[model samples]
Target: MPDSPYVAMGPRVAIRHTERNDRAEFTRLSRTSAALHHPWLTAPSTDEAFDIFMTKLERDDHEGFLVCLPETGAIAGFINVNSIVRGAFQGGTIGYGAFAPHAGHGYVSEGLGLVLAYAFGPLGLHRIEVNIQPGNEASLALVKRYGFRLEGFSPDYLYIEGAWRDHERYAITSDMFEAQG
Candidate 1:
């Protein structure tokens, strides 16, 4: 791993942009985490899927990042900022998944804080939103820990695992960022 592009760093974790070379390890991690992610999310678990995933990340509207253990450079999880809108909106939505062995270890929380700083500072984003399935307590807790407030609810907001899933929306704005401090 090279020097990280982290805007925020904790003792145990560093967050940085995803690299093309991460395909193998990311796929392996996603595969192993199937049980943990099942009804909630699905990360790219194959080379072909990773290729497509990377292509999307290369676009202006999407950014993908890897959360890694600083010492070992082992990926703990990934976060993506999608459908970024500039001009007046200056906002984006977030999606993330934690790899097995790292899940429930608080690494995701540390990494998310870094991502929020990067988004609000360098990326010039004013707001970030997350839509999570209601039953996904871990994910809800993660966002809540970061001070995102529940905004609203959407019925069949996203299609996941061949079904349209209901989602609870949460968000934090740049104004809210200061309040968190």
Candidate 2:
């Protein structure tokens, strides 16, 4: 068997491409993060959710990484770059969430930094965007701290929990990434 090409964050914490062996932990993490949403989390089942998550993992249009804690071998969070648009626009959107236990410790921020590096450095993605609900103060604060510029407000941009939620669009380009240094 060839070695896994996934990224590592720490002895216990890693940002790795999803693997079949990770299904159970990823399912647990998904269900946990879903609970934190204001609207409540909804999914068919852990197995079904795993299938959906794996579908994203297998696609070239997106990249998904699971944040795992080696001590317990549990998934603590997840990050992904989705809806990649190439050609003159080599960019993608960022989506992520942290499990309840992993929240408030800057885990997501660290994960975001690594994911952004992968997007801009390894993936050659020129721009990355985040669409977050205006009411999600935690998420808003996170993107702001990362120097993402507020682009605009998008109404009914995503369906979360159940209802169509409005989102505030934020973006960071490779130039912005360089400027930050």
TM-score of 1: 0.95
lDDT of 1 by residue, 53-75 (tens): 99999999998999999788889
- The most accurate candidate by TM-score is 1
Instruction: Give the poorly placed runs of model 2, Cα more than 4 Å off.
Output: 1-13, 40-45, 70-73
**Model 2, range 1-181, lDDT digits (tens) per residue?**
1364557565336677767667766666556666674452343238867787678768898998776665665666778899998899999998887777887777777778778877898899999999988888888898888799999999998887668988999999988987877
Model 1 lDDT, residue 43, Cα: 93
Task: Quote the lDDT for 143 in model 2.
Answer: 88
Q: lDDT of candidate 1 vs native?
A: 0.92
How many pairs collide in each candidate, listed in order? Answer: 0, 0
